[model samples]
Target: MIERILEQSKALIHVLSADRRTRHLVLTWQDTEVLESIHKTLHPLQEFTDALSGEEYVSISYLKPVLHLLKTKTLAEDPVDTDLTKSIKSRVIGYLQDKYNDPITQELLDIASFLDPRFKTNYIGKENIPAVKARMKAKMEEGTRKEKRSRVRDTEFNSLT
Candidate 1:
Protein backbone atom coordinates (compact mmCIF):
# COMPACT_ATOMS: atom_id res chain seq x y z
CA MET A 1 0.00 0.00 0.00
CA ILE A 2 2.82 2.38 0.87
CA GLU A 3 4.64 1.51 -2.31
CA ARG A 4 1.49 2.14 -4.34
CA ILE A 5 0.96 5.53 -2.74
CA LEU A 6 4.58 6.48 -3.37
CA GLU A 7 4.41 5.28 -6.97
CA GLN A 8 1.26 7.32 -7.60
CA SER A 9 2.91 10.39 -6.12
CA LYS A 10 5.91 9.85 -8.34
CA ALA A 11 3.67 9.49 -11.38
CA LEU A 12 1.94 12.74 -10.49
CA ILE A 13 5.27 14.44 -10.09
CA HIS A 14 6.30 13.13 -13.47
CA VAL A 15 3.11 14.41 -15.12
CA LEU A 16 3.56 17.82 -13.54
CA SER A 17 7.17 17.95 -14.61
CA ALA A 18 6.28 16.93 -18.14
CA ASP A 19 3.52 19.46 -18.79
CA ARG A 20 4.55 21.99 -21.41
CA ARG A 21 2.38 24.96 -20.41
CA THR A 22 2.01 24.70 -16.63
CA ARG A 23 5.46 23.12 -16.33
CA HIS A 24 7.25 26.31 -17.27
CA LEU A 25 4.85 28.41 -15.19
CA VAL A 26 5.04 26.32 -12.01
CA LEU A 27 8.52 24.80 -11.96
CA THR A 28 10.40 27.76 -10.55
CA TRP A 29 13.53 27.33 -8.41
CA GLN A 30 11.52 28.06 -5.29
CA ASP A 31 8.88 25.52 -6.28
CA THR A 32 11.56 22.93 -6.86
CA GLU A 33 13.06 23.71 -3.46
CA VAL A 34 9.67 23.33 -1.76
CA LEU A 35 9.05 20.01 -3.54
CA GLU A 36 12.45 18.77 -2.44
CA SER A 37 11.71 19.80 1.11
CA ILE A 38 8.38 17.95 1.07
CA HIS A 39 10.00 14.86 -0.42
CA LYS A 40 12.72 14.84 2.23
CA THR A 41 10.16 15.18 4.98
CA LEU A 42 7.96 12.39 3.61
CA HIS A 43 10.73 9.84 2.98
CA PRO A 44 11.28 8.98 6.63
CA LEU A 45 7.55 8.79 7.24
CA GLN A 46 7.27 6.37 4.35
CA GLU A 47 9.96 4.21 5.92
CA PHE A 48 8.21 4.34 9.30
CA THR A 49 4.88 3.47 7.75
CA ASP A 50 6.44 0.55 5.96
CA ALA A 51 7.92 -0.68 9.20
CA LEU A 52 4.59 -0.35 10.97
CA SER A 53 2.76 -2.16 8.13
CA GLY A 54 4.66 -5.32 9.05
CA GLU A 55 3.48 -5.20 12.66
CA GLU A 56 0.35 -7.03 13.84
CA TYR A 57 -0.55 -4.14 16.13
CA VAL A 58 0.56 -0.61 15.46
CA SER A 59 0.03 1.42 18.64
CA ILE A 60 -1.11 5.04 18.78
CA SER A 61 2.18 5.66 20.63
CA TYR A 62 3.81 5.88 17.16
CA LEU A 63 1.87 9.03 16.32
CA LYS A 64 3.60 11.31 18.85
CA PRO A 65 7.08 10.67 17.52
CA VAL A 66 5.91 10.84 13.90
CA LEU A 67 4.25 14.20 14.55
CA HIS A 68 7.41 15.44 16.27
CA LEU A 69 9.54 14.31 13.34
CA LEU A 70 7.25 16.03 10.82
CA LYS A 71 7.35 19.32 12.76
CA THR A 72 11.10 19.16 13.26
CA LYS A 73 11.89 18.34 9.62
CA THR A 74 9.54 20.96 8.18
CA LEU A 75 11.11 23.61 10.43
CA ALA A 76 14.65 22.49 9.74
CA GLU A 77 14.41 22.88 5.95
CA ASP A 78 16.40 25.87 4.75
CA PRO A 79 14.41 28.69 3.15
CA VAL A 80 15.37 28.97 -0.49
CA ASP A 81 12.94 31.88 -0.74
CA THR A 82 11.75 33.31 2.53
CA ASP A 83 8.22 34.15 1.42
CA LEU A 84 7.59 30.80 -0.29
CA THR A 85 9.14 28.75 2.52
CA LYS A 86 7.15 30.67 5.12
CA SER A 87 3.93 30.09 3.18
CA ILE A 88 4.59 26.38 2.79
CA LYS A 89 5.64 25.97 6.41
CA SER A 90 2.61 27.88 7.67
CA ARG A 91 0.24 25.72 5.61
CA VAL A 92 1.82 22.45 6.78
CA ILE A 93 1.92 23.56 10.43
CA GLY A 94 -1.68 24.74 10.30
CA TYR A 95 -2.86 21.45 8.82
CA LEU A 96 -1.05 19.38 11.44
CA GLN A 97 -2.19 21.58 14.33
CA ASP A 98 -5.77 21.56 13.13
CA LYS A 99 -5.85 17.78 12.84
CA TYR A 100 -3.93 16.77 15.98
CA ASN A 101 -4.49 19.55 18.51
CA ASP A 102 -7.63 18.10 20.07
CA PRO A 103 -7.25 17.52 23.81
CA ILE A 104 -8.62 13.97 23.69
CA THR A 105 -6.33 12.93 20.83
CA GLN A 106 -3.30 14.48 22.52
CA GLU A 107 -4.14 12.79 25.81
CA LEU A 108 -4.48 9.42 24.06
CA LEU A 109 -1.13 9.88 22.34
CA ASP A 110 0.48 10.94 25.62
CA ILE A 111 -0.97 7.98 27.48
CA ALA A 112 0.22 5.58 24.78
CA SER A 113 3.70 7.11 24.96
CA PHE A 114 3.73 6.89 28.75
CA LEU A 115 2.61 3.26 28.75
CA ASP A 116 5.24 2.08 26.28
CA PRO A 117 8.22 0.87 28.30
CA ARG A 118 10.64 1.89 25.54
CA PHE A 119 9.36 5.47 25.49
CA LYS A 120 7.87 5.73 28.98
CA THR A 121 7.91 9.55 29.70
CA ASN A 122 11.02 10.19 27.62
CA TYR A 123 9.26 11.86 24.72
CA ILE A 124 6.59 13.54 26.86
CA GLY A 125 7.04 17.11 28.07
CA LYS A 126 7.65 17.77 31.75
CA GLU A 127 4.47 19.80 32.02
CA ASN A 128 2.42 16.92 30.57
CA ILE A 129 4.10 14.12 32.52
CA PRO A 130 1.83 14.35 35.58
CA ALA A 131 -1.31 14.55 33.48
CA VAL A 132 -0.25 11.63 31.27
CA LYS A 133 0.55 9.51 34.33
CA ALA A 134 -2.82 10.35 35.84
CA ARG A 135 -4.59 9.39 32.66
CA MET A 136 -2.68 6.12 32.51
CA LYS A 137 -3.73 5.30 36.06
CA ALA A 138 -7.37 6.00 35.23
CA LYS A 139 -7.22 3.78 32.15
CA MET A 140 -5.63 0.90 34.08
CA GLU A 141 -8.24 1.21 36.80
CA GLU A 142 -11.02 1.14 34.24
CA GLY A 143 -9.59 -2.02 32.69
CA THR A 144 -9.33 -3.64 36.11
CA ARG A 145 -12.94 -2.78 36.89
CA LYS A 146 -14.12 -4.20 33.57
CA GLU A 147 -12.18 -7.42 34.12
CA LYS A 148 -13.63 -7.82 37.62
CA ARG A 149 -17.14 -7.31 36.31
CA SER A 150 -16.58 -9.90 33.59
CA ARG A 151 -15.27 -12.46 36.11
CA VAL A 152 -18.18 -11.85 38.45
CA ARG A 153 -20.64 -12.42 35.61
CA ASP A 154 -18.87 -15.62 34.66
CA THR A 155 -18.92 -16.89 38.28
CA GLU A 156 -22.61 -16.05 38.66
CA PHE A 157 -23.46 -17.86 35.44
CA ASN A 158 -21.47 -20.90 36.58
CA SER A 159 -23.25 -20.95 39.96
CA LEU A 160 -26.65 -20.78 38.28
CA THR A 161 -25.75 -23.67 35.96
Candidate 2:
Protein backbone atom coordinates (compact mmCIF):
# COMPACT_ATOMS: atom_id res chain seq x y z
CA MET A 1 0.00 0.00 0.00
CA ILE A 2 2.84 2.40 0.83
CA GLU A 3 4.50 1.63 -2.55
CA ARG A 4 1.18 2.28 -4.34
CA ILE A 5 0.76 5.61 -2.53
CA LEU A 6 4.31 6.62 -3.47
CA GLU A 7 3.64 5.77 -7.13
CA GLN A 8 0.37 7.75 -7.06
CA SER A 9 2.10 10.77 -5.52
CA LYS A 10 4.82 10.63 -8.17
CA ALA A 11 2.19 10.59 -10.92
CA LEU A 12 0.34 13.46 -9.34
CA ILE A 13 3.51 15.52 -9.17
CA HIS A 14 4.25 14.77 -12.82
CA VAL A 15 0.73 15.82 -13.84
CA LEU A 16 0.93 19.02 -11.80
CA SER A 17 4.30 19.93 -13.30
CA ALA A 18 2.93 19.34 -16.78
CA ASP A 19 -0.10 21.51 -16.03
CA ARG A 20 2.15 24.30 -14.76
CA ARG A 21 4.28 24.14 -17.89
CA THR A 22 1.16 24.29 -20.07
CA ARG A 23 -0.07 27.35 -18.19
CA HIS A 24 3.31 29.05 -18.56
CA LEU A 25 3.32 28.34 -22.27
CA VAL A 26 -0.21 29.64 -22.67
CA LEU A 27 0.65 32.85 -20.87
CA THR A 28 3.76 33.43 -22.98
CA TRP A 29 2.39 32.37 -26.36
CA GLN A 30 1.38 35.91 -27.23
CA ASP A 31 4.95 37.13 -26.80
CA THR A 32 6.15 34.39 -29.13
CA GLU A 33 3.58 35.44 -31.72
CA VAL A 34 4.65 39.09 -31.47
CA LEU A 35 8.31 38.15 -31.90
CA GLU A 36 7.49 35.93 -34.87
CA SER A 37 5.54 38.71 -36.55
CA ILE A 38 8.39 41.15 -36.00
CA HIS A 39 10.87 38.67 -37.47
CA LYS A 40 8.69 38.02 -40.49
CA THR A 41 8.11 41.69 -41.19
CA LEU A 42 11.77 42.69 -40.78
CA HIS A 43 13.46 39.70 -42.43
CA PRO A 44 12.81 40.96 -45.94
CA LEU A 45 14.12 44.40 -45.01
CA GLN A 46 17.28 42.80 -43.74
CA GLU A 47 17.68 40.91 -47.00
CA PHE A 48 17.17 44.15 -48.91
CA THR A 49 19.99 45.79 -46.95
CA ASP A 50 22.29 42.97 -47.96
CA ALA A 51 21.69 43.84 -51.61
CA LEU A 52 22.47 47.57 -51.26
CA SER A 53 25.81 49.38 -51.20
CA GLY A 54 26.91 51.21 -48.03
CA GLU A 55 25.70 54.70 -48.98
CA GLU A 56 22.35 53.72 -50.46
CA TYR A 57 21.70 51.22 -47.71
CA VAL A 58 22.21 53.71 -44.88
CA SER A 59 20.25 56.66 -46.30
CA ILE A 60 17.28 58.06 -44.36
CA SER A 61 15.13 57.44 -47.44
CA TYR A 62 15.36 53.74 -46.72
CA LEU A 63 13.44 54.36 -43.50
CA LYS A 64 10.39 55.56 -45.40
CA PRO A 65 9.66 52.27 -47.11
CA VAL A 66 10.67 50.25 -44.07
CA LEU A 67 8.42 52.27 -41.79
CA HIS A 68 5.57 51.89 -44.26
CA LEU A 69 6.02 48.15 -44.37
CA LEU A 70 6.33 47.83 -40.61
CA LYS A 71 3.26 49.96 -39.99
CA THR A 72 1.22 47.93 -42.44
CA LYS A 73 2.26 44.65 -40.93
CA THR A 74 2.13 45.60 -37.27
CA LEU A 75 -1.13 47.52 -37.38
CA ALA A 76 -3.10 44.61 -38.79
CA GLU A 77 -5.06 42.45 -36.37
CA ASP A 78 -3.57 39.09 -35.48
CA PRO A 79 -5.33 36.03 -34.09
CA VAL A 80 -3.03 35.70 -31.10
CA ASP A 81 -2.58 39.40 -30.44
CA THR A 82 -2.23 40.83 -26.96
CA ASP A 83 -1.97 44.27 -25.37
CA LEU A 84 1.81 43.97 -25.37
CA THR A 85 1.80 43.48 -29.11
CA LYS A 86 -0.42 46.50 -29.61
CA SER A 87 1.82 48.57 -27.37
CA ILE A 88 4.89 47.56 -29.34
CA LYS A 89 3.25 48.54 -32.60
CA SER A 90 2.19 51.89 -31.19
CA ARG A 91 5.69 52.51 -29.86
CA VAL A 92 7.22 51.82 -33.23
CA ILE A 93 4.86 54.20 -34.96
CA GLY A 94 5.40 56.85 -32.33
CA TYR A 95 9.16 56.51 -32.54
CA LEU A 96 9.20 56.88 -36.31
CA GLN A 97 6.87 59.86 -36.15
CA ASP A 98 8.90 61.53 -33.45
CA LYS A 99 12.23 61.05 -35.18
CA TYR A 100 11.31 61.68 -38.82
CA ASN A 101 8.02 63.54 -39.01
CA ASP A 102 9.50 67.03 -38.76
CA PRO A 103 9.64 69.25 -41.85
CA ILE A 104 13.41 69.76 -41.82
CA THR A 105 14.17 66.04 -41.61
CA GLN A 106 11.48 65.27 -44.14
CA GLU A 107 12.98 67.85 -46.49
CA LEU A 108 16.42 66.34 -46.05
CA LEU A 109 15.11 62.86 -46.75
CA ASP A 110 13.26 64.15 -49.80
CA ILE A 111 16.42 65.82 -51.08
CA ALA A 112 18.48 62.70 -50.55
CA SER A 113 15.85 60.63 -52.27
CA PHE A 114 15.53 63.08 -55.14
CA LEU A 115 19.29 63.12 -55.68
CA ASP A 116 19.27 59.37 -56.19
CA PRO A 117 18.65 59.07 -59.93
CA ARG A 118 16.88 55.78 -59.50
CA PHE A 119 14.08 57.48 -57.55
CA LYS A 120 14.43 61.22 -58.28
CA THR A 121 11.36 62.48 -56.38
CA ASN A 122 9.22 59.90 -58.17
CA TYR A 123 8.20 58.41 -54.84
CA ILE A 124 7.48 61.80 -53.24
CA GLY A 125 3.92 63.05 -53.26
CA LYS A 126 2.95 65.77 -55.71
CA GLU A 127 1.91 68.17 -52.94
CA ASN A 128 5.25 67.81 -51.16
CA ILE A 129 7.48 67.97 -54.23
CA PRO A 130 7.20 71.73 -54.68
CA ALA A 131 8.08 72.45 -51.06
CA VAL A 132 10.96 69.98 -51.15
CA LYS A 133 12.28 71.52 -54.35
CA ALA A 134 12.13 74.95 -52.82
CA ARG A 135 14.04 73.75 -49.78
CA MET A 136 16.63 72.12 -52.04
CA LYS A 137 17.06 75.33 -53.99
CA ALA A 138 17.52 77.30 -50.79
CA LYS A 139 20.17 74.85 -49.58
CA MET A 140 22.04 75.09 -52.88
CA GLU A 141 22.03 78.86 -52.68
CA GLU A 142 23.31 78.77 -49.13
CA GLY A 143 26.15 76.44 -50.14
CA THR A 144 27.12 78.73 -53.00
CA ARG A 145 27.09 81.76 -50.72
CA LYS A 146 29.35 80.02 -48.24
CA GLU A 147 31.72 79.01 -50.98
CA LYS A 148 31.94 82.59 -52.26
CA ARG A 149 32.63 83.88 -48.80
CA SER A 150 35.43 81.35 -48.35
CA ARG A 151 36.92 82.36 -51.69
CA VAL A 152 36.83 86.04 -50.72
CA ARG A 153 38.63 85.27 -47.45
CA ASP A 154 41.27 83.32 -49.35
CA THR A 155 41.85 86.24 -51.80
CA GLU A 156 42.14 88.75 -48.94
CA PHE A 157 44.74 86.56 -47.18
CA ASN A 158 46.75 86.14 -50.40
CA SER A 159 46.71 89.90 -50.97
CA LEU A 160 47.90 90.60 -47.43
CA THR A 161 50.77 88.07 -47.84
Candidate 3:
Protein backbone atom coordinates (compact mmCIF):
# COMPACT_ATOMS: atom_id res chain seq x y z
CA MET A 1 0.00 0.00 0.00
CA ILE A 2 2.68 2.44 1.01
CA GLU A 3 4.80 1.37 -1.93
CA ARG A 4 2.04 2.03 -4.48
CA ILE A 5 1.25 5.33 -2.86
CA LEU A 6 4.90 6.36 -3.04
CA GLU A 7 5.08 5.47 -6.75
CA GLN A 8 1.90 7.25 -7.77
CA SER A 9 2.46 10.18 -5.48
CA LYS A 10 5.98 10.75 -6.78
CA ALA A 11 4.73 11.00 -10.33
CA LEU A 12 1.84 13.24 -9.32
CA ILE A 13 4.15 15.37 -7.22
CA HIS A 14 6.30 15.88 -10.34
CA VAL A 15 3.30 16.97 -12.41
CA LEU A 16 2.08 19.27 -9.67
CA SER A 17 5.52 20.80 -9.27
CA ALA A 18 5.42 21.94 -12.92
CA ASP A 19 2.63 24.42 -12.06
CA ARG A 20 3.67 27.65 -10.27
CA ARG A 21 0.57 27.50 -8.02
CA THR A 22 1.28 23.94 -6.77
CA ARG A 23 5.09 23.98 -6.72
CA HIS A 24 5.01 24.46 -2.97
CA LEU A 25 3.07 21.21 -2.61
CA VAL A 26 5.93 19.22 -4.13
CA LEU A 27 8.15 17.27 -1.82
CA THR A 28 11.53 18.82 -1.06
CA TRP A 29 14.52 17.12 -2.71
CA GLN A 30 15.49 15.41 0.55
CA ASP A 31 11.96 14.08 1.01
CA THR A 32 12.00 12.82 -2.53
CA GLU A 33 15.25 11.00 -1.71
CA VAL A 34 13.51 9.43 1.27
CA LEU A 35 10.67 8.26 -0.97
CA GLU A 36 13.15 6.72 -3.38
CA SER A 37 14.87 5.00 -0.50
CA ILE A 38 11.55 3.54 0.61
CA HIS A 39 10.88 2.29 -2.91
CA LYS A 40 14.30 0.63 -3.10
CA THR A 41 13.83 -0.99 0.30
CA LEU A 42 10.41 -2.43 -0.52
CA HIS A 43 10.78 -3.38 -4.18
CA PRO A 44 12.29 -6.80 -3.49
CA LEU A 45 9.48 -7.72 -1.13
CA GLN A 46 6.95 -7.01 -3.87
CA GLU A 47 8.79 -9.36 -6.18
CA PHE A 48 8.89 -12.05 -3.53
CA THR A 49 5.21 -11.58 -2.73
CA ASP A 50 4.24 -11.87 -6.37
CA ALA A 51 6.37 -14.94 -6.93
CA LEU A 52 5.14 -16.72 -3.82
CA SER A 53 1.51 -15.94 -4.56
CA GLY A 54 1.63 -17.55 -7.98
CA GLU A 55 -0.64 -20.58 -8.58
CA GLU A 56 1.72 -22.83 -10.52
CA TYR A 57 4.08 -23.60 -7.66
CA VAL A 58 3.82 -24.65 -4.04
CA SER A 59 4.88 -21.88 -1.60
CA ILE A 60 5.13 -23.47 1.82
CA SER A 61 8.58 -24.90 1.23
CA TYR A 62 9.83 -21.50 0.15
CA LEU A 63 9.12 -19.86 3.51
CA LYS A 64 12.46 -20.60 5.17
CA PRO A 65 14.65 -19.87 2.19
CA VAL A 66 12.82 -16.67 1.37
CA LEU A 67 12.91 -15.53 4.97
CA HIS A 68 16.61 -16.28 5.14
CA LEU A 69 17.28 -14.34 1.95
CA LEU A 70 15.29 -11.36 3.21
CA LYS A 71 17.26 -11.21 6.42
CA THR A 72 20.73 -11.90 5.13
CA LYS A 73 20.76 -10.44 1.67
CA THR A 74 17.75 -8.58 0.25
CA LEU A 75 17.00 -6.50 3.33
CA ALA A 76 20.47 -6.47 4.85
CA GLU A 77 21.76 -3.02 5.68
CA ASP A 78 23.91 -1.44 3.02
CA PRO A 79 26.31 1.49 3.43
CA VAL A 80 24.13 3.50 1.07
CA ASP A 81 20.88 2.85 2.91
CA THR A 82 19.32 5.90 4.52
CA ASP A 83 18.37 5.69 8.19
CA LEU A 84 14.69 5.45 7.32
CA THR A 85 15.36 2.66 4.86
CA LYS A 86 17.37 0.84 7.50
CA SER A 87 14.54 1.19 9.98
CA ILE A 88 12.00 -0.10 7.51
CA LYS A 89 14.15 -3.09 6.64
CA SER A 90 14.86 -3.88 10.26
CA ARG A 91 11.22 -3.64 11.25
CA VAL A 92 10.15 -5.97 8.45
CA ILE A 93 12.89 -8.47 9.22
CA GLY A 94 12.19 -8.33 12.95
CA TYR A 95 8.48 -8.87 12.54
CA LEU A 96 9.00 -11.91 10.35
CA GLN A 97 11.62 -13.25 12.75
CA ASP A 98 9.19 -12.94 15.61
CA LYS A 99 6.46 -14.78 13.72
CA TYR A 100 8.72 -17.75 12.92
CA ASN A 101 10.57 -17.70 16.25
CA ASP A 102 8.31 -20.21 17.93
CA PRO A 103 10.14 -23.52 18.19
CA ILE A 104 7.23 -25.58 16.90
CA THR A 105 6.53 -23.25 14.01
CA GLN A 106 10.20 -23.09 13.07
CA GLU A 107 10.46 -26.85 13.18
CA LEU A 108 7.37 -27.26 11.04
CA LEU A 109 8.74 -24.90 8.42
CA ASP A 110 12.09 -26.66 8.51
CA ILE A 111 10.33 -29.98 8.05
CA ALA A 112 8.38 -28.66 5.13
CA SER A 113 11.59 -27.44 3.53
CA PHE A 114 13.20 -30.79 4.20
CA LEU A 115 10.35 -32.67 2.59
CA ASP A 116 10.41 -30.57 -0.54
CA PRO A 117 12.51 -32.30 -3.19
CA ARG A 118 13.82 -29.01 -4.48
CA PHE A 119 14.93 -27.81 -1.04
CA LYS A 120 15.49 -31.00 1.02
CA THR A 121 17.34 -29.80 4.10
CA ASN A 122 19.16 -26.97 2.31
CA TYR A 123 17.68 -24.31 4.56
CA ILE A 124 18.13 -26.34 7.76
CA GLY A 125 21.15 -25.87 9.96
CA LYS A 126 23.80 -28.57 10.05
CA GLU A 127 23.19 -29.20 13.75
CA ASN A 128 19.48 -29.62 13.09
CA ILE A 129 19.81 -31.90 10.08
CA PRO A 130 19.97 -35.14 12.05
CA ALA A 131 17.03 -34.14 14.17
CA VAL A 132 14.97 -33.26 11.11
CA LYS A 133 15.88 -36.58 9.54
CA ALA A 134 14.93 -38.44 12.69
CA ARG A 135 11.57 -36.71 12.73
CA MET A 136 10.99 -37.57 9.11
CA LYS A 137 11.93 -41.20 9.68
CA ALA A 138 9.62 -41.45 12.66
CA LYS A 139 6.65 -40.14 10.65
CA MET A 140 7.43 -42.52 7.80
CA GLU A 141 7.59 -45.46 10.18
CA GLU A 142 4.33 -44.50 11.83
CA GLY A 143 2.63 -44.34 8.45
CA THR A 144 4.06 -47.72 7.43
CA ARG A 145 2.90 -49.35 10.65
CA LYS A 146 -0.61 -48.03 10.16
CA GLU A 147 -0.69 -49.39 6.63
CA LYS A 148 0.48 -52.79 7.83
CA ARG A 149 -2.22 -52.92 10.47
CA SER A 150 -4.85 -51.99 7.90
CA ARG A 151 -3.66 -54.70 5.55
CA VAL A 152 -3.80 -57.32 8.31
CA ARG A 153 -7.35 -56.29 9.17
CA ASP A 154 -8.37 -56.60 5.52
CA THR A 155 -6.69 -60.03 5.22
CA GLU A 156 -8.41 -61.33 8.34
CA PHE A 157 -11.78 -60.06 7.10
CA ASN A 158 -11.26 -61.79 3.75
CA SER A 159 -10.42 -65.08 5.42
CA LEU A 160 -13.61 -64.93 7.49
CA THR A 161 -15.71 -64.18 4.42
Per-candidate TM-score against the hidden true structure: 0.61, 0.52, 0.85
lDDT per residue for candidate 2 within 55-156, as digits (tens), equals 545555565555555566645446675666556556766776898889887777777777777677766767989987897899899999999999999999
Candidate 2 — worst ten consecutive residues by lDDT sum? 1-10
Which window of ten consecutive residues has the lowest lDDT sum in model 1? Answer: 1-10
* Poorly placed runs, candidate 1 (over 4 Å): 1-56, 77-83
Per-residue CA lDDT of model 1 for 76-142, tens digit only, reads 4565635555566667667878998998888788888877777888778799998877867888899
lDDT of each: 0.70, 0.64, 0.89
Which of candidates 1 and 3 reaches a greater TM-score?
3
Sort the predicted structures by lDDT, highest score first. Answer: 3, 1, 2
Please give the lDDT score at residue 23 for candidate 3: 85
Model 3 residue runs over 4 Å out of place are 1-14, 17-24
Model 2 CA RMSD to the hidden true structure, in angstroms = 10.7
Off by over 4 Å in 2: 1-57, 69-95
* Best-matching candidate per TM-score: 3
Model 3 clashing-pair count: 0
Q: Please give the lDDT score for candidate 3.
A: 0.89
Clashing pairs in 3: none
What are the RMSDs of all candidates, in order? 6.1, 10.7, 2.6
